[model samples]
Target: MKVFTTTLGEIGNQLSLRLDSKYRETWDNEKGDPIKKTSLNKIKVADLINRLPIKRVKKGELEDECNLLSISETEAKYGRLVNSIQPVTSVGSDKTILNEAEIIVSKLVMSKGYIFTNEESSTDLIGSTELIPYKKRKKDIDLTFIRHLLLLDDYLKYYSGLETGKTPSQKRVNPIDFLQLLVPNVPYDIQKEIGTKIRKLENEMDELKKEIQNRNKIINEILATEFNIDFQEVLDIKKPTTYKKDLLSINNSFDLRFSYKFNAQKYKKLLSKIAQHKVSPLKDFINEPIRLGSSISPSDYDDDNGEAIYISMSSIKNWTLDKDGSRRVSEEYFEKNKVANSIKKGDIIIARSGEGTIGKVALIEDDIDAIFADFTMRVRISNSHNPKYFYYYFCSDLFQLIVEKEKKGLGNNTNFFPNQLKRFPIIQVSLNQQNEIVKKIEEKLEKVRQAEMALVSKKLEIDNLIRKAIV
Candidate 1:
């Protein structure tokens, strides 16, 4: 008989099902939140089996006794929802030490997405929940097959729907459901080779992700250290400025109304710098204004309508627009929200609401002409200055210092208006300097984009290979 077959044909082929309760005992919390030694003393195997936070499973019965092991908390330290396995060979009557018998897996609610390993020892499990332990097999299943199965399109669709509220409930893989799913009964030797290949690919992907995260962290650090500014400093600005024109008021026939104490000396100097750069206020930038408390419906929003892309608090990212991930609104919603004419190309999207991320920023792509969502500010700079340079400047320490000193007045809900933006100073620099800065940024960003594309290619390769394997 052929060992390899379609995934559908693999159903019910030499697989054994074992309920969590059959192999392990649960431990309960004797104390309120943190169990004290006194409370632990009262915990008996029978009394705590159903109530304990830890999960314990027996590997094999030795004579009349069963062996137990504990899983290490390594996965938890990495913010993973799983536990790394560490077996406990020796178990005393009082405390259990993890050794050869335990195959540790995370007991947390989020462990379903992680990979599981039991290469070293395959005994019973101890001090874990949610992770399902398969019945001991004469031929152990390949970890690669398990990993691939976890990432399958069908599995992800089902896993994504899992909900874990407040306290821990069994939000992991349902062993019963999984047992019913089909699995390719590849020979043990072939399975191991496949598992090895899968591990190698997984390592490469993990390395790339780490590299990108590190690069981003470096960028953030440069902006903070070299520029001498902190994120909290920018968050301290309390003044709100309304715009007379720019993004929000451009469509109005009458002069835009805004309150501002524009300093004549500063305005004159700023304008002179603009003239030297050969930039015009109207062409260079517009004031992006966002209203507060607007409701949005996503299903009705479409992007190909030749209207400006609507930017909202949800649309802003560190330096890029999350167009694919953002919620869109129809032109009618823009009219309803009264910000129908507030967005423009080469604008800056600024977050004004949502806790902890109130001052996030994203540069709008020129192709994006969406409207500004409520509680977001779209800052459009004029052609006189480089738009990209202006973006970096907003990210710089000097302007952030101004925001820190000015805008403030509420709980977690402070914001900037048009007048506040108009009054905010843009560093007076020659057009040549602005151009130079923009050129350098474009070059650096292009490299980053290329690196990101490579990652995408790698993902496609792996995904395609898995799809072929299951065929």
Candidate 2:
């Protein structure tokens, strides 16, 4: 364990009466302290930029066609911030007009703050109330440098430590407190040079991301070709609010649910088209029944001294298991629920619920003393099937479309149940053919992964360049 001490004067200087050890410990380990005592001068963030007045306007007040930037659209890419543009009509909330601003930062969740540096554009842009916009008051400092500075790991931690609210989601950094933070007064020439280098790296990173996206498309294309169906057409089918279905159709189906999602005609037609190839139900290849994982409450989490790892939905990403973010449970819980929760080599895990997370699939390649959470489901393929082939099939676009059509729930709590998963149609091919397809797909994906890792290294180099600039 680590310990630190600070005086009452230090707490008073923070302008916050927070007495929590977590906040005090973080404040004591300041990231900008070294720069504060350096020979170089320092500047308050307020002096460097003009905080734009918060303007709240109803949706009807602005033109529907105007570009609107939401907090969700803004993201930190590589070492720089970026945002996507959408028409104002897409959002219903009151917004703040972003006029002549050089940078926009999210006030909520300072640790994962979405910061975007605007470029010269002809389109009118407005943002969400959660965003705080600022313009460069003086031409001496670089806004790009400041954006990267705000994104630094230590600085984000420091800012997050200053957040005030009752709960994690409600926590926000006061704009006044944010503006009072200090930054190194790097010369204009050095700042501009560092910004230029960071931009160059950002461009390279963008290209790598595009390459990875295109390579991923190859897997979908391969699935489409093998199944002899146009995946694009499957995606193009429009979902109507109401659709007609014969009574016999409803009676013949296993699922009695009458929701539009479960009985869409266009989806049925697409499935019929896919049925032209030799297809089998997903249940045919699985030896055991599809099992939903056991739930462990947050109170039961033993992060510091647990015997077994607990894999949540977040642990499964891009068809891979990222154990780094997983939590832990006690030995008692692991042993009691091992039959339903235990995962081993050759097992496939799929996220059964949650928006943006459902349908995510990962194949376990090694035996580990870990169990999946309740929001996920596990499938153990029989000896007759190639596990990798089924894993790739689950990752395919066709399967994802099926998931979209089958998932049922209101709002963001949609779920793809085990029954729905069992009914999914899997295109059947010879074991040798399946192995060949998996081999080719794996070879291509390996190259893409290598390129992705290279871009990660480049981002670190850019970060190091920014760190050196401040010194």
Candidate 3:
């Protein structure tokens, strides 16, 4: 008699059935708004989560601010990606202790940032917050697979479901609850295969993204070279010999950054770029006067049937507004405050303050019954400036760098004052050149956008296949 062995394909088919059932359960288990009506998702996340004690280093032990993780950094990647960070709070009621279990969760979030670690090491995690250092082979689990799982839509929805709190700042997720979520259980060898496959797909996607970014860099490089702008020199760190004396003056004047030389030089360099061309104070180029957003509380309004849309600062991202994330105000409130908080077409919007969101600029392209919150600012950019061109530059790194330095405060309290926004500069070129630049940039951007859409479709297909593969 001949014996037969089960194939990976057979395992995957079974997994697909299991995932379909899981999706049905989740759809039926709807708690609040579904965002989209489409049915969702696969794989049991609980089986894959390696429940281990978290560790964190103290704020005092680390000299650099970037070493400490902030809550604002937690919004994306299951609170994993640590793009940048501020040092621990020097003076605040909420303090973080270093090298402990509370900090351990932070490590779990960013463990993948470290790619090359010795698997033989006894410590599953390293002391430094830069890497995820966990080692447990006796149980034979895969962290890479788990990391990607945390990034999945099914997992994110479940995680969001676990969160409690009426508003964003007040909201929090329980680590214990997160650990309890179910995950697909597969053979150890198969787990590694799924992880490796997903990593490769991500790498391919990343490479294509790099190409798109390089194309954008080409646009900025063209702008700089054509205008002979040397940003490095303009932003040089070399200060005067009497820096200490000037530093006192800067502090006394209430500038948190104390970058007197940089700001002064930046103006000189900007003027140099303009040459003899007429420059406009951001105020001059505004037809409708610039004003800060209203202090209306979002908690006051109902979600669906409000008279007007209440725009939250969170809805403004990378020069675009997410209407779904916005809140709706009651009819009475809208009627009373609509004139004061009106956002007309062609008006520019910016996130004025708060952690993770300062100086995020977007343009209102539609006329709608919407009212921006207190943490936002609005201005109708004049006909003199091209809204697209101005918005593109506002979203650029060069502009963000300025905003980053100018912003004040720590943690969730971080703020960009209204006075600073009022004083912002608006550089102008001929309307024809603005049109040409916009035309050139959009042409390349459209290609990148199409490629990105295809990439997303490909990713979803691969993710579904992976769910099926190991199940």
Candidate 4:
């Protein structure tokens, strides 16, 4: 009997597992002609399958299909499923749901591709695209084999269209269209073997995530236990004495408390002393205050290699410094602008504007001549300022709570002017007390960081082994 395989373009082009679209070749960092590729596919969803047996199963049932039954239902479900990991509570009525074993189809739309699913498994109000059944098809290829084949670049390219100017529009993949594509004939036993290997790798990734979370918890506990700080104190900048209810400044610090282990005793103590600071809008007491990007002359800046370290928006994440990928500028640019006065290693860099991350802070550890970008604000504490203490304080749950409360706008982004950032409130502590807190935090954080690195290395090893086994 002749075997049948589905191509990605045959499916409707919205979002799904069958939608595999190959990305066009692009220039690499070395300017070499090396081709870059991804394993993702664009699936085209269609109005078909509304009558299919798209039953909503519990997470346990789905896990059983993937494990004991050795079945695959890898479709992205809109509403909550039995084993939904990243549960989306706010799914639209039209959204689709697929058994964890079903495959999502894809059709390349632009430089990147979108996912597709079917209505039978999805909510009618949410309007999900479509779901293609790999397990149901009685072909030489097993479900796992189908999943692996869909991950190939050849299928994506076959379904993807030509580049129009700089943008490319990929053809969508419909269910009927996908079932007609040519697929490799692989043995069922081989597919099962590969699936086992892939699952093992995925487990490693999960372990790494858990390890990182726990590590961060340790850091939080140390802060709570040693510093006597509550993770949720609201720093009241304007007293009732200063302004009426309408004008009073009340900011709930960041919700970092969620990331930390809660300590009721420490929280109570911190709350009791909230009004101790007599000053309005407390200062962190820095020796040198640095304004980002102001030190560089506009004429001297270059995108290429310069002597100076440039801290771009991408260089910072979770208020921690990403030293390897941060931007760099020319050293000569620093001298010409006379911008080096206040820039220092210990300065806390804060985001001035952007979505959701406005007022995020990072401590500079690089000693090189570095300049901040326009979107960043830099501050250095004076002799009175303790760098380590300030680092912990900025990263504290209470501080982040205050920041979100003061958040002005909406959407994925946010912004705060330099003056507004300066006026942003902080919890005031004595210099000696601040140093003590920072010391404890560093010791605990160091242990956490070490554990996280080990877990990451193990995950990388597991992924490499699985990929090698498949290839």
TM-score of each: 0.55, 0.85, 0.61, 0.59
The order of the candidates by lDDT, greatest first, is 2, 3, 4, 1
Give the per-residue lDDT of model 3 (tens digit) for 273-301.
54544455566667766788877764668
Candidate 2 vs candidate 3: the TM-score winner is: 2
User: Order the candidates by TM-score, highest first — what do you get?
Assistant: 2, 3, 4, 1
Candidate 2 lDDT by residue in tens digits, 1-471: 555687898778776566666667766666224244445678887888889887766756554566777555455442243436666554577777776678877787766756777744425677778878788898777766777777777567777777777888778887777787787778889988988887777778778877675544878877777777787777677544567988898888887777776788888877887789898999999989998998887777788888688888998976689877788888888888887779999999999888899998988998998888889999999988799999998887768878988988988999988888998998889999899889888887888888889888987887788778776
Clash totals for all candidate models: 50, 0, 24, 83
lDDT of each: 0.46, 0.78, 0.56, 0.46
Q: Candidate 4 on 227-315: residue-level lDDT in tens?
A: 45453343332212221222121224332222111222333334455444532343446544446555345555566766566676666
Provide the global lDDT of candidate 2 against the true structure.
Answer: 0.78
Winning model by lDDT? 2
lDDT of 3 at 370: 87
Please tell me which predicted candidate would have the highest TM-score against the true structure.
Answer: 2
Clashes of 2: 0
Per-residue lDDT for 1-471 in model 1, tens only? 222223322333323332232111110111111112121122111221111233343443333333333334442212111224444444433332223322233333433344344554544434344443332233455644445544555544443233233454545543333333334334456556666766666567556654453333344354444334453433333334443435444335233323232321333333343244333332225443333335456665776662435566766666567766665567676666544445556767666655555656677656553666667666666556667767776665444434433344466765555556555555455779667656655565566667677767765665555554544
Worst 10 residues of 4 by lDDT: 26-35
Instruction: Report the backbone clash tally of model 3.
Output: 24
